[model samples]
Target: MQMSNRIKEIIEVILNSKGYVTIGEIAKQINVSDRTVYREIPEVTEIMREYGVQLNTVSKKGMAAVGSLEDMKSLRISLGMEKQIYIVDPRERIDFILLYLLQQDDYIKTEALAIDHHTSVPTVRNDLKKVKEQLGVYDLHLIQKKGEGILLTGSEIEKNALMINILLNHADEATLYQWLRREGDVSNPFTKRMEEYGYLDVMSACYLRMKNIIRDQCELPAMIKDREYLEYILLIAMMIGCHQKGQPYEKVFETENFKGEEQRVTRQVKRELEEEFHILLSQEEEQYIKWVLHMGMIQDTSSVYTVKNRILDSKIHTFIEYVEDRMGLQLIRDKELKESLYVHIERALTRIRSGMCISNPLIEDVKKDYEELFGIIREGADRIFQDDFFPDDEIGYLVLYFAVSLDKVMKRSFRILVVCSGGMGSSKMLAHRVEQEIPEICVSKEVSLVGFGQENLDEYDLILSTIPLYIDKRNYLKVSPLLSSNELEQIHEAIKRHKYKTMRKITVREQERRQLESRDNIESLETLRLLMDTGLRVIRQFRIVETREKDLKNNLLRILSEESLCSLPETEEKMKKQQSYYIPVTDMVYYEAVLARMPEPKLFAAHYHDDQYLSNGEKYTDVIYAVYPDQASEYEKNILNRMLESVIEDRDIQEMIHRADEKGVRQWFGYQFKQYLAELLAV
Candidate 1:
């Protein structure tokens, strides 16, 4: 006899407590009334009698389990509470019902489900409604027949797909890894649930062989390095197991037309699986496996520039452009954003085309924080794809990419100095953790305690030390080298306080500057003098032209030579050594920015009218070439940062710079410099 969830909780409380637990305590713990607890006592007593255990109730102390430890263990296992916590949450119950129905070959009575979950038939019926809605997404149906019961009916492939989705949603990577290795916790609720559904048997049959096959492949080692690859491997094992059971995937697609390294790898994998499992695979199965491997490769590889899918590529470009227009922000210039979105969407589209659903666990949080952006991207994606396949989960992933891009544009990075008493290894580790946890912070320097005493602390925005300091506590925060969660919270609070103080100081300075400005024209002339001296030098070196050349190095050489900013051979040598200096801004307006060191500060910018693809496969119509001296002043750096900020933040400035001629570009720069100086003085 299956015990109800309430009875299980009561028994657990008694077994775990050192002394007897009162009826009122049990009632409160399980959120039930004392009268209800009294009503269930007889049933609990009867259930314990079968396991050789007795439920003993004292006069005023309430009840306790009086039996051998062995009997108590047996009773816990019988109640499914030996290793797992018995949960009565509605969602978990609904998931249990779905899994139960899918694993059964014939109809099961509604009363049976009610009995298994220890709930009312009416509660089970409500859960079935949600189960039916979820199944409909996979084109599966929950059929109810009079007098017989209910069953899940769908293609085997669809059933398998839904099963994988549920498994991934319930269990995390570490748990799945443990399960595949046969070291899984028997007490884990998800593990026990999988055992009940008979999936563990399927996993056991093919896991070892699949692991060996994937491990042997040279290309797969990199892919499997990520824990997420375990999910794919588990899915493959399940598919092979299903085929061995004579329920092969029946959907037919053309397998003969596929080509490339991924296809070759798929063929080898198919041969090995067929031989090991003693089952002949269908053409559709071969194609499905090929698609799965292809997605794995996409996830592993960084650059998808060489692997071209013209139709999907076009759709991605259109999607980016649509988002750009709606948000009035320039996202196309963000190289990492474009590349990452391309890879993600490519895999997403493949999943949709293959009738596989994608799950985003953070979908709710993404919607909450980025509600407006999520809606805009959803509409844009739906309109671009012209289909209903793009679910909110997929759109949520897309929103994260744009949200990160916006943060990069808008965030003010803080410079951090890390001081640790430990060796360089521990100091570096702490620094890495800091950057990982707080994206808005940059670890500018790492120093030992001795080195810290000799350096100027005012250069850094915040100082994090591993050891306690002799100076004022407010000057630095003490954190563990490992940076525990509590220490991380302390650092966050410190940063917030620092930001508030900085803003207050700025406000005070602005008030003082305003009072001085009203007194005389002396300060006003000083601002103009500073702008004319440094800002004019940068604007004077700006150049714009129409070019058809695709080679960025050659274009930079010609422009720098014309302006006589630096030696041609020196610039060429530097360009060859560090190609990272060529920063691609955007494909929407087509611009690249290059930075290098020179004897004097200089900025050489070119606006090309003709569109051309560079050697890196990115199209460009504008290039801003800048060179700064090794000892350039902070004011010079600020001017350059302001220029780039204007191009990114001001749409009108971007258009003016794009359409303006050489002299026109210089005049626009001079006007922008005046505005920059005014804002600087005001701040």
Candidate 2:
């Protein structure tokens, strides 16, 4: 035996003797690293399973040797044979190279083959020879040079020809489909060829089914299905047997009828199965299918009668009564197989056979309880929005609201803030429920009714009211008469009917209206922008003229000390003109005067006034003073940029500035000015 075989044997003995050997122990016994020992376990387990030997783990902390000594010996022998690589015929070397390339790294590195193949440089060279030989088979070339090393070179269109050949010759149809499903990009030439050959659709369906089955049957161990065969049979069965046309069995059921029967039989079997085994079937319909297959395959008439009697037995009846008492399902009354009734019955039987049962009934009892709880909340939110008194139960209703909320987030382009009064927990509940309804309309910020008066409501696109909030704001879009689940459904329908494009158009119209108003509002924005630009200019001047030490001190002193011009105290006389004034910039008086003019003037100052250069006014004499002027250095430019930033903290304005910068405005201006100078000289 090889050295690797001997090491593997010693590790296995330690694992069997210890019941659970640590990585360190395995390494010490086998003379390998802990990683090697850990990696070997999975490989060894696979080899052992083929020989009827089992390895079981206890809580993933301990291992157990499950089979007898004889079983171990059989597994050891099988494992030795399994580890050996099958030799490729010389003619089939190209097929091997194609397989190898399929498993290659992201970049086709020509660094000698990866160590795992356990081959020398010369052996790898010979392997490349085989690979090159195979490329010729596909009318392609294996390009190699001293520095460039090896590369598979060919027209992208013909590249897949060799891969297809290998798939056809070396791999089974099912394996080929599985491989293509994972590695073959649909847009790739190879995948397109497969699709053109009509194999891709079947492969996709098989892959989808496999994924669905894994997700649905959580506890069931994965079983590798022959995807191609499964897809072919399923398609035929769906087309023929489901249609009940030209089939061996004349009474073949259509999809609808089959579905109905499945529901009915499933409910019946579930009831009986639950009574006998007490296992609650997690996936009732899937379990029903298995039961149906078992029923279809029955050979004995006596067995059929025995099973049928079991379905109608008193034990089953008693269990049904238990389900009713616990879950409020009066099952005895509903003799007709309704969808839910059939589903419940099937699930019940499935649970019994599986030996895992839950007392929770499959009827509407659960839904009813949740519905009643949320209904009360919906009523409270509606009443609160209407300015009615909130009841004591409003707090409990709030929790249910969030539980039923939508599980999506706002899109990047839009944002909305939800505001509500503190009482009855209506604000939280409304926020929860609305988020549930329209996920894209996020509650970016939540403000209580008390603090809501303090919020800058202009930031949000939509203002949803749980109550009729009267603040003299007209721009807000309101969905009134706060909604229940039914009402919300109506709102959703209205929104969908309106369409996203229409909503966007409305948003655009609103924006345009704001833009018109901005003309009057531009002075305040201009003054703000000037302030930011001034601050940035001051910093830039200090950086360029003063040493690092002086620059730091100057910045510190500027922030720490207040100038008389920066601070303006409000008198009671001036306070009368404005009910309240929260000063944002040093030139509050100037800013307020700008705001007083309203929409039109403000728009001109903000949009039309090109004040980016800080050249609009004299140093310290203008709304903002520039720190440096002579050289107009980068530092001075940075200061001007900062003042403009402070002018408006709005994200949209900043984004506009960024776009302007990207357009190379300075370069454009220089080119135009130079051209004008040349024209002047010519004149």
Candidate 3:
């Protein structure tokens, strides 16, 4: 059925939102009344159904079009919103024009070129000026005849290099992979332009086969298995496919002399291609592949060290010394930093010498964040290299290396113990995350619940656990295995608290210690009084029940309302507004577990179970709900957070909750409370 433009606009707004879009939001976006939008809902829903999209609406939270990305793309195409023939952006138009001319062997008329681009002859003429300057970089020329339109005059080798450069500069490896695999958005500007020249079709045919040949046949270094190597394989495949299809740049030439290893690897690549694809590679093609492979290997320090360049090494040492003297730092002492810098500088020098440009996508970000450091490095590079050969892109990369080294040298490291349910994969992952996110932390050990219980707690400055520690240990914080931003801030605060305590202890005299002990006794008494009151209320209200409800939202409503913990509408609204509060804990086990928070301030804990699939397609068999008071003191908040973490991390607690063992749950809570009291009085 044909839909009106208003209905299409409403559908577009719904599809664009990542989450639920309210009726008011849609109305405002389309400049219509809420009533008019309501009138169009049925028609919009009907049209969406044809594309396998479901229009899901909630009472308070508006509506969302739920479907696969492909379905959405198809719906957009049906609405005539996906592909545009004419390029609008001037920069993009120049790129497409260059690609168009390079793919053609015969000279075309200016009018035909203008018609293909859907632009005027004057605009095409203006774009050709910039294109000419770009061509000059590779020693290529744009020759125009009075009658004939234009022709790209250059060696096959130089033209091929320019083509590869354009592709690299246009998209990064991830985007290229998506395009080559036919997984990228078809309407993207780059994809649309490349498709106009049939580049996508050629890449789709050669991508997987070339990937396999490179992986199985080439003797690649360990460190070169990243994006750089992927790009190298992509370019080689493109050159080969373009040659086989009788493209303009297919002339063969004699191979140039290369290193023994590069020649051997290139021969294997050529043999594999000829055997598998039934096409022989010319010597010039072999030479190009060999050169590309060598360039990729230069990024790997281990591979570069295999063939030492004394001059490059000497220059790098001098560069490091210059930066060290300027910044009053001892960077020369860092061996790893020196090695990484050497590899990057070597790659940068090669690209510079060969008139090749490497794009740094993060150059602007690096300049903004480290403006002063960027200037110093740029100056050092200019002085050491005897000219300003390094562009801002290369300078930006160098700045990152020194920035990281400087961070490590300046930050004070503290020993930490990372605890989890098991001292295995999950614990190691958490440990790595802590060290990566908080460089000030040095993980002293990764321990399981059982291992943590037996260790001397005073050995480490702080203990971070993915699960709850029932015992009330000082300097302990419960954190998610995958730490979020808020949790990171909490960790920083915990470090500050520990530092303050340590300073107080160090400065205290014997008399001050005695006085502090006397004051602590009074505070301990008050803490005990508050703990008993909160503990009784929590233990009395704790609940565990086995449920048969299959729908997650329905089960949440039933549990929350039936227990009188929170009202149904409040729970529903919270669920709709904050979907992120519902977290999936693990999927390695037979039954998936999810933890959810309640909006209410009352202390409440419960377990509900049913056989259902989570949004991620995991089969969820259990849901643990934890509600902490909105107005809670530090001690109370810590207790509730740890309790929730225990439900998330402790397998035993999970098993008990899943079994709906009320007796066991109560007993565990009592024991944990006792431990908390004992630790409090001891302190």
Candidate 4:
């Protein structure tokens, strides 16, 4: 889907400003209602169909967009110049006061503003009237101090402006704009000049931004304006830029005040950077970079070294290797100057931290722009991670190629064992097939059928088999008789069952916690444990029961007649169905005689020997255990003896006694439960 030109313009404007612009602001820009703007967003997004543009809602603020520099450039090209325009139209004196308040360095009282502008206090008071009107258009406000002065309340816009100014101050706008103008013209003179400065991609642009800052000094609002201090600041920014571009440059900062301190720190930084990034820098440069980064940069610079839990420029390049191995992608080749993979790497690392679990999508995007030598191929799904479903043919191919890549970096050979038999022809065929499937796998040995079962299983991490053989110990996964349809189906079913079990536990726990909201009789440890055990048993048994009228009707009758079966639905559609039985019930109760005599005494355990537990072919469901849990362990023999006695004594009057007990003496109800169970069972 493609977004309308209007909505596209709104997104570009929001991103370019780097501030949370409200829906009203966007509406005014395109001359639309707040409702219309909200309606267009989702619809326009569907049209664009690009996941690269991220939309987020800020608390107490409005919507905002975040994307890469390339994504930003694309958006800008689509929106054109209409989106860049900002109008500060104020209708009242307060609005004017607010604007002036935001711009002024010192607080200005209404009396002061009146005197400065040669106007009366009433005139200045009248200017304050426009403040509310301006609030509807922009995220700005003015504070009145009764008599002291009026001050600006919001400073987000100023913060953004400061950052932008710092970034753009190094290169003249004309030169940068011209380079931007001929963006796609690879052979253009401006492009060539940018290339010479190492600005091939956004990395180059960032390099320039840093380079200019280093070459020319900057003065923050907090600093007293001085040419010498300003010059040093610019040099500091340039040094950061050079470090960003992966360039090695000497540092000449005067460190006489803390020469010893600087020298010790500089040595550590150089050693650390070299050990981490595999890139070496002189001790002087390292110290200069460290001092500037720690003291000069606005944001914390510690993150520069730590990218996604690994050192960014470490000697082992652990992060880079991990990303390459996982993402299966690489950087674009540029000869103008070798660009460090650090910039893109940091972003990717940040993304990984933000829940990017899979690397294929990110890798594929990079591969589109870089060729084979520069582009990385993920060591297939099998090599990077374990997959029980990996095919025998694909396995060999993946192993061979993946091993070669690992060998290039780590210089290690992997040993593989091929277990085959039947004859030399079959064994040779298996070896050839294995070699083709995983070209990188070095088959150290091939064994025949004679000792295959007795052979050491510890030699291989994975086993491929055409026939079943048992080797019980060690870390190993069997690829199966073949990577066939049945195997895949089995894996899918296993995963589904695992997921369902997890969901069941979560659902039951949530329901249990919710019981605190009401007086639910079933909410107790013993009752819950019984319910869990019963539910799982019923779930397992139902999978095997076949559909038949006799079976369904009998099961339903058995559930309906149970002592505390309570109730069930009378849905006509369910009754008319001639399929496998399914019962949805909230409660069930076990007969006391059965509960007492049974040794396990579990909540969900059900043994339907007759039709008493079912009702109208709906099938008996939700078996409830009725035994006293405290007496379970010690009184098992006593309970069985009482169960036989109750059968004979209350064989006829058990139901009547139960109803009477339920109404008056519920505590003594367990004593009569065995009698009711005996009569119900007619045993």
lDDT of 1 by residue, 1-683 (tens): 77888888777777655457898998888899999988988988998889988988889888877776567769878866665444477776777778778788899999998887678999999999989867655768899998999999987777776777667767767666656666513234666677766777667656666777777777667754444466666667778877777777767644454447768778887887888777888888888787666666645334465555667667878888987766645778788888888878877876777677766657768998776677678879879998646877788899999888866643344567898885777679889999899878668899988788887876766678888877655456678778999778867765664554433333333433444456467876765576468887788866665565556667767666666666778666544222322322333232333345554556555566677565556565666555555566655666765565555434345555566566766776777778867765653
Model 3 has how many clashing residue pairs?
1
Number of clashing residue pairs, candidate 4: 47
lDDT of 2 at 681: 29
Task: Work out the TM-score per prediction.
Answer: 0.52, 0.20, 0.50, 0.26
Better of 1 and 3 by lDDT: 1
Candidate 2: where is the Cα deviation over 4 Å?
A: 1-158, 161-416, 440-448, 456-462, 470-475, 481-683
True-vs-predicted CA distance for residue 510, candidate 2, Å? 28
Candidate 4 is scored at a TM of: 0.26
Global CA lDDT computed for model 3: 0.67
List where candidate 3 sits over 4 angstroms from the true fold.
10-49, 52-76, 82-175, 183-185, 217-221, 241-264, 275-279, 298-307, 364-372, 410-437, 440-683
Candidate number of the best TM-score? 1
lDDT of 4: 0.40
Native-to-model Cα distance after best TM-score fit, residue 21 in candidate 2, in Å: 61
TM-score between model 2 and native = 0.20
Q: 243-319, model 2: which lDDT tens digit per residue?
A: 22222212212223233443554455444433433334335333433333332221222332255445434443453
Evaluated at residue 613, the lDDT of candidate 3 is: 63
| lDDT, model 3, position 512 | 27
For every candidate structure, what is the RMSD over all alpha carbons to the true structure, in angstroms? Answer: 22.2, 29.9, 18.3, 21.9
